[model samples]
Target: MIKKLFIIIACILLLSSCSNRVDKGKLNKVGMLVPETINDQVWGTKGYKGLLNIQNDFDVDVYYKEGIENASAIEHAVSEFKQKNVNLIFGHGFEYADTFNKIAKKYPTIHFVSFNGDATQKNTTSLRFEGHAMGFFGGMTAAHMSTTKKIGIIATHSWQPEIKGFVEGAKYEDPNITVLLKYTDNWDDGQKAVGLLDKLLDEEVDVVYPAGDGFNVPVIEKIKEKGLYAIGYVSDQSDLGKNTVLTSTIQQASKLYDIVAKKYAEGTLQSGNLSFDFQDGVIEMGKFSPRVDEKFQRKMKRFVKKYKETGDLPK
Candidate 1:
């Protein structure tokens, strides 16, 4: 019975393709639904870039919808994509996994994919970045670059395995390093991020970073105002705030999008979990500002190797 079910699922997966204009071989349209603004230059931006990568590299046409937050909104978005006959529907965040999975099931002929999402379902695939290890290196970089030996992470959400991995990364950077972690309850509340970073500054923490998307910019500005340090995530952000940024541990999620979308076009779309890490250089550490110094970079290089070797940060 199990063998039969596997065969059935495999058969469905093989038939994953559906033409947009008609049920033909080539796909002329791809739809991207985003939870945040694409110009966020952070989370949503990475996704938009990925979609563009696929669009530019292939013969398929692309359509995008952004700023989807509510549960109902996500469902509506997926339904809309299905109606338009998008060959591939890309959801940029894990937040959309549940809805995407459901909609994909309803439209198995339509290809669906998510970035940084863990859930798996028939006709649906999710990909996640190995930010835990990269976050560890980010934390280590924070440790080496900080003048106070005390750092802060202004998260936009309470916490989860994913965020915990970031915290664990910080801890392993130094058993003695004190990490002041706090949440701003939402990602777009840049003022709140600034306030949280301000409080950390009162405690005399010279370096602070925000792990939440779109929240990093404000705190980075605040860090500059207080003559402190900050880091970026999701994209190469060293150029975003010249001297204040220590570095950014960026996830090139868009790059992955390019690969998956193309494979999908070539009749080679595989249904499974896909991951990228620092060792693969998919997760890149951004260039540090001059303040980071030669010693800090050297220390980070050694720690990076230690991380690739052991699958964890140097303790």
Candidate 2:
């Protein structure tokens, strides 16, 4: 009995150690790094919006350097922020993961946050988006909304887990529903995206989901031009076209930033990998277009309910 009691105590202590939330005292200045201009209305812009909100609510001095791409530029930005003695560094996007991992080790005094990041370091926190749920929703929605019973996903890269989840979701909605996957080797090549959309449209894919940052703009334009339905990705782009967008799967970056900032203030912020999903109130589907009727909304609501309860895509 005494040995069992000791084992229980040890287990409790181990759990506590694993979640060692250190109080860094009061935070002063915060720094932000984005690969693209904050005004790009997508990934970079979303992070910038979070910084703005952090500044407004927390009353902390916030400095950001946008349009800084490549590893050297990121390294330079980190050095500059370190010199400024910033309390926290927010590196927006997975691209900053490696750089943050390197810099966080060198600057152990400062806390590092990577939004949609993949670093797993002692001083760095990686906040990743669980996009599988989003993808499932996209597929289910497309399957329900598609007139041709065919949907297409135009992404910057080929299939990942999220894309697979999307395909699974569509198949779950309708086993017979056809999902076409296409990729644009270049994220900045809107024309390539448009070209891919043309092919999908030709193949009778009436519902199109564009899954790139700004590359989706022209793809959405093409969908509108063809009078086809569109599903936006990464950001809410309902207002981008002539109301052809059925809905958008969005990452609520501001809410993420707010959570981290509040946690930091509460001295409960731990350095590790954190993920946000639909269950976490981070990944969300934007307002549906008029094209999506009330019945479709009800179906989506039911699916969401089931997914939330099971943490699995509705079978």
Candidate 3:
């Protein structure tokens, strides 16, 4: 009778242990929330592509919702994902940070990820791109290529570190280079950005960096019309115009998603804010325009190789 009791106890313990163990392989359901439509051909499109990559690589059921900008909308979306038993959720932008933090407490088993924001909870992670180095390179290209020695950067906000990097890089290339900096206070104001670009042109600025994804394409188009040079942002804009666009500061969002998914599958994805850069293959310079002289292109290649090796940009 005691032997039978012992057997029953062992069976109960085994069942309990089985219930407590999380099969990392069963991390099969993933969800993403984006602030706008995924067809924007820049940031949104990159994020959606990342999601698709995750779906393909992990064979997971992936879900995404567009236009989830507000906390209320985020809550609703997260709740829907929760109902569907999502194991991981991506917020896709910095705006989702606080909302994800608050909601994460309610869904402790679910992990949340976002971009360019603070992560205070154990279940949340923020992925910040080290864009400053790429921005610095863009500035160097502008300074090298500018005919008038005057360049400009039209950015979406003042808090961007890339703005400082651009200025520093331009000055490093040529101490006398003039950098006209202006802000749009938001990301999507193409009209205002174009107006600012005109103002820079008035200053005889021969090169411009329109850093807002929403407005950069149109601003680059305008720059092309004026026969001026431009530094592309977010994606490779050489396809837009080989002669007009010098090069692009690229963020490999899809590759990042693949990395994160792999880490999660390996049970190594930790919660907290994480930064990725050239070393991580997350940040890189896109193809240089043929308009960029071969000498300068060779110089850029050397600099990129050194940076990747030493985590140092051109001094």
Candidate 4:
């Protein structure tokens, strides 16, 4: 009777251990695909850090391949993750929308997530913020700080949403303020931004706000030389131009990743789009420049308070 009881207890312990191993294995597999090198400081780097946070928090197996640009490359990378049976996959840009939408059809079991994108499929989820909301915050600062009553927004493309928000925000501060809009054909070309800056300066733009990634450095450099003010985007680029940059509108990428990851781990993450905004705390305002006086800071605080309360810009 004692021998039989021991045999039954050992069999039960072995089965429980195997079951636990399988469950832990399923929870550990997380993969990410970055469109560019993870060293880009703002966009790519933030995504990388977010994944790292997810790994650290969940104690999961993490894999990432950077510089995977284009539809074919994204497809290949995601396919490899699928083969490895990664439980979740994150594609960190809007550019991955179509590819993820297409590929997600084949893998119904894996959860696909996108940052700064739309989720069109059932198995996919997206976390995107309104760029215009952040642009509005920057524009409001620029309008208030401009001595010339003229401000400029520079970007690689028109980006109507951000431009519209900038204009609206400026008009909210002072209806008579002039808002100049300039677009460089390329995002990284410093010369293009310089040429655009010359035009904006010719029109007496005293506060220049750069919306394009990487364009902030060159534009801020020129703004500093001209003894003018500027606003940064994506990251807190105040360090890039301390006295010149009045403030920045930031994207909290890692925080967003952690939010989604927790939901996923809890098996509560849903499909479709998750639209984040200033109200959602994903779109944030960076530190105010020392040049920004306490009076204006108080006013900004009030504006933000009103926004949070009403879900609309203060009139």
Return the top candidate by lDDT.
3
Q: List, residue by residue over 1-315, the lDDT tens digit for candidate 4.
A: 999999999999987655543223335478888876788887778888988887766767789999787889988888888788787888887677778888888888888888656788988988776777677778888998999999998887775467788888888888899998998877567788889999999999999888876577778888999899989887888997678999998878887887777778777888988877777677788899999888988888787777767887766
Clashes by residue pair, model 2: none
Worst 10 residues of 2 by lDDT: 17-26
Q: Compared with the true structure, what per-residue lDDT tens digits does model 2 show for residues 5-89?
A: 9999999997776555433356767889887788878877888888887776676778999877778998888889889888788
Model 2 residue 283 distance off true place after TM-score fit, in angstroms: 1.3
Question: lDDT per prediction?
Answer: 0.74, 0.81, 0.90, 0.81
lDDT per residue for candidate 1 within 1-315, as digits (tens), equals: 999999999887755532212222455578888877888767887788888877666646788988886679977877787787787888777777777766666777777787656556767788877667767767777876666779888887654333666567666766677888888887778888888887888887877768877678777766777777787766667776768788887788787886676677677777757776776556778887787778768877887787777766655
Residue 8 accuracy (lDDT) in model 2: 100
Q: Which portions of model 4 miss their true places by more than 4 Å?
A: 1-27, 185-191
Worst 10 residues of 4 by lDDT: 19-28
Winning candidate number (TM-score): 3
A best-first ranking of the candidates according to their TM-score comes to: 3, 2, 4, 1
Instruction: Provide the lDDT at 61 for model 1.
Output: 75
Give the per-residue lDDT of model 3 (tens digit) for 1-315. 999999999999988766754344747699999998899999899999998887766667899999999999999999999999998999989899998888888998788999889999998999988878888999999999998999999999887878888998899889999999999987889999999999999999999999889899999999999998999998989988999999999888989988888888787898998989899998889898888999999998899889999988777
Off by over 4 Å in 1: 1-28, 158-173, 266-268, 305-312
- Say what the RMSD of model 4 is: 7.4
Better of 1 and 2 by lDDT: 2
Candidate 4 clashing pairs, residues 3+ apart or interchain? none
In terms of lDDT, model 2 sits at 0.81
